[model samples]
Target: MMIRIRSRDGLERVSVDNPAATVAELKFAIESQLRVPVHAQILSTNQNLLLAKAPGDLNKFTDMLDPNARVSALGISHGSIVFLAYEGERTVAGPAFHPSGSFGKKMTMDDLIAKQMRITRQENPHCELVSFDRDAANAFQHYVNESLAFAVKRGGFMYGTVSEEGKVEVDFIYEPPQQGTEDNLILLRDPEEEKFVEAIALGLQMRKVGFIFTQTISQDKKDYTMSNAEVLQAVELHAEGDLKEWVTAVVKLEVNEDGGADVHFEAFQMSDMCVRLFKEGWFETEVKGEIDPKLSRMKKDVVVGGKDVTSVDNDFFLVVVKIFDHQGPLATTFPVENRRIPVSPGALRSHLDRSRNLPFVKRISDFHLLLFLSKYLDVNSDVPALSGCVRAQATVPEGYQLLIESMASAC
Candidate 1:
């Protein structure tokens, strides 16, 4: 029997020979097979337990605290998923998979050719079109342009709806904590804050649709549409999103014919082959300084235009998607999150005061505002309740109004 274990690294399986294994036996097996020490392991049936940060936090989950408990009694059977947490890092061994010519066998030319990966342009993207809410789009670009001056990279996740026709409508952009340099963007994701964002989106009938990023001015001089680093980052996120229509949008400053700089937006979907290569661990994620920016390095040689090579042109992995703008239902008057300057309660008070003439529901319709309130309100109840009112354009309950006002005034 095999039990799947999900941790920060990814999912791996631990084999158990016994049908009725004890919790102690299961932990022993994990220790021997996965190379994680039994004393350092923290097991839980709840996936959220993996997000626990401290010893005090881990104590809250008592599902697998008793080692004497029987695996069957705990409802852990073959193929059941068990979440894991540990004190330090371990090199997680993935499932057994061998590349071509690795089985102590000599391969014929035809066999090698058959294994060769061919790069071709994807003519059409799965995402038919992507429409951004005018205000939401403006708010994002305005900040990067005005504040950052497009000198450093910045990124965010697009949240909105997808229509039956495969068209994506982006209503908001949630910027996670990140460090951006002139050439690289690193996202420092917050799982706790993301949970609140998810809850708010759930109540407002929306979801994460795509990824958005800005290119620095130094990158504008480059010839490639997207650098190798950018391609790797975008494809990884697209694969993780698991949405066929997921879009990757780039914001940059382009020199117009008038010799003035203009903010430009372009969208693309990673080609199917690109996502497959990323998931299959073919692309070399580590960006070497000597590597060309226009090409992506693969661990093995792949056929590019009938020639075997370790580097493939970045353009081959991109499928352009059409972009449009629309007036969405949500507002963008509230301060955004994950910015250099933290959002304060005074900003919330100012937002409420500025919109005093508007209805309570209208005042709280913005996604940023909802995100702010989500930090204080109950995600399971208060968040959905308030977002539901905004969705239906219904009246905000007096209780919620008072609570929000009190929170705004508390600071």
Candidate 2:
């Protein structure tokens, strides 16, 4: 279809190829063809609003759009879009008026608490598989209460999708361990790791919460290690079929009676060496030594030992991602620029994208992300504290943050 619109100044024509293309794509196409930044871009769809000045925050400006990540091909949920007006107070470059004659919904405190893009709502094909689990509401967000300093978890164990009632639904969902399917486990990479880390940081600061997860898939529970060193060498462990299932043994840790912790690790005795090497960070240590590269290489050989594994083989563990009760809070007052109705800063939006807007708004318009945390798990535990930017905005250095500890955490 060819589209031609006569503006007050002149005539404009555009050709459509993929009707399936979303408003986001159309806007991008127009921007690309016209060589204009989305900030000043004018788009008339269901309703109109200025495109937000932030990248990674697409939902705000194109809530009704189809989020198709061609590069990664991950389509975004349409309801995730939000209308963005360039200025914190208003949009001055909107020549196209919205049919609804309004600027869409205004963001609220609850929205901030939910860390939702008020402008965007999840689209209709909302995956009916997602049923509500009232039992775990916001339970997964509790991890944000950790001391507001730099912290990262291997993975998140808890979180729920945005609920229809506008509340966040948290849950401890489980999936059977893959007997031997590599595709069954979608392992995350560094960018995804950073994405979670950023969300964790913001959730702790703004929502007083985030998540930690360990899918059985995320762990390698293949019993590769053995209590007997001789067994590891004598028994060649290989699956019989072209699709071999490597069963890696795994273990959990507990705080022992003597105040020291007893880490009961599972796996072949050969792997014991590596697990021991992993201990320094989780405890309170400032510095760490690098493991000899030779050690890692040698260990891989010992495990594979010519095991005819398939083309795809990675670690998987069906551990839990849990959000503990927060011992902190999100900042109520961080600075925000009111230059326009939505004067979103690029840095701030980038952070939200990095965090996937995890049910908390730590920094809005270069503002702060805030959440409420009890220094203890509850009032019975202790006074509620705050984390992230709240601590940063405190006496701590601008680039640094103070800390807070939760009474109950890392479950």
Candidate 3:
């Protein structure tokens, strides 16, 4: 069985053969797999433990204190996600950086640092409007609101189309492996899984259009719409995407006049200035508690509202985009990917059986379901062929249908 471990670093998995393994054994596995020393590590089922400010505060969480306690006794099992807090410097590997020659001219690193882009606010967003597929939006929100109870942050990549009028329509959301705390969201991206997603999107004639994330309940009381960390993450992705119309969507719970919690969605495009600053390495990435969450700290003073300052308000970097909804072509009923519960082969069989009365293409008109099949079938050929058939709503080849049914029965 595989158990997920989420820490400040990110989400990772460890395997154990026995379901009845002790908590001590689980810690040992974590130590070996994650490389945090057993003694320095503090494990808990409560996600709030990761928010502890001081070493003294950690004692309040006693959920996983007993080493001898059986993992199953504590309601942990395969696909269960546990929280981890550790003390000390744990090295996380980062991508290798290779600087390019300065436009074929020889310049010292010191000279390059003197020529960073000046920060500015953008009055208008490149994206005029952003629309969501009703079912896809509902599915993404329902899990975070009900199952997770808005206690932690969550994020996914929005996949769909961008129009010549600068309108962005999100048909689906592809969630990557990630760990979220009350204040932080760490996306542990998988290149292999993304390749499958890209292939399916290609067959469907769609592309990745935006990024979406949910804020925790704790963040509701904050003064700002987005924190500095959030601005950094959003802008980084915006820069990487290189899409002038790329949108960033936020999902949150707000209290209404009757004291009822309502799910609200807002869309924005990181201001052109924000993306430029992020790409040019002008914003400070390290977050400290002393710094205000509403403002982003900069490496040097930048002009904002005609004043030079070391920090800029996060709101200054966000340009609101209008929101709308539409009924997309694909269905979102199949179970979402990368949630706590594993999507088993039985799910495939059940889905096939439930939709048997419909056309073969209609039976498999789900992005997540296609994603599942993509893992087993050839990404370069078979995945695209199946997705192409679904896109056209054409009759599936008999041999392909037989192959799919055989896969479902193998469960």
The lDDT leader among the candidates is: 1
TM-score of every prediction relative to native: 0.74, 0.18, 0.72
The runs of at least 3 residues in candidate 1 whose Cα sits more than 4 Å from the true structure, single-residue gaps closed, are: 1-114
Residue 188, candidate 3: alpha-carbon lDDT = 97
Q: What pairs collide in candidate 3?
A: none
Q: Write the per-residue lDDT of candidate 1 for residues 82-176, one digit (tens) a residue.
A: 87777776654433422342433333434433344567899999878999999999999999999999999999999999999999999999999
Which window of ten consecutive residues has the lowest lDDT sum in model 2? 310-319
How well is each residue in 288-330 modelled by candidate 2, as lDDT tens digits? Answer: 1342211122211111222312111112111112222222223
TM-score leaderboard ranking: 1, 3, 2
lDDT of 1 at 303: 73
RMSD of 3: 25.4
Compare candidates 1 and 2 on lDDT and give the better one: 1
**Worst-scoring 10-residue span by lDDT in model 1:** 97-106
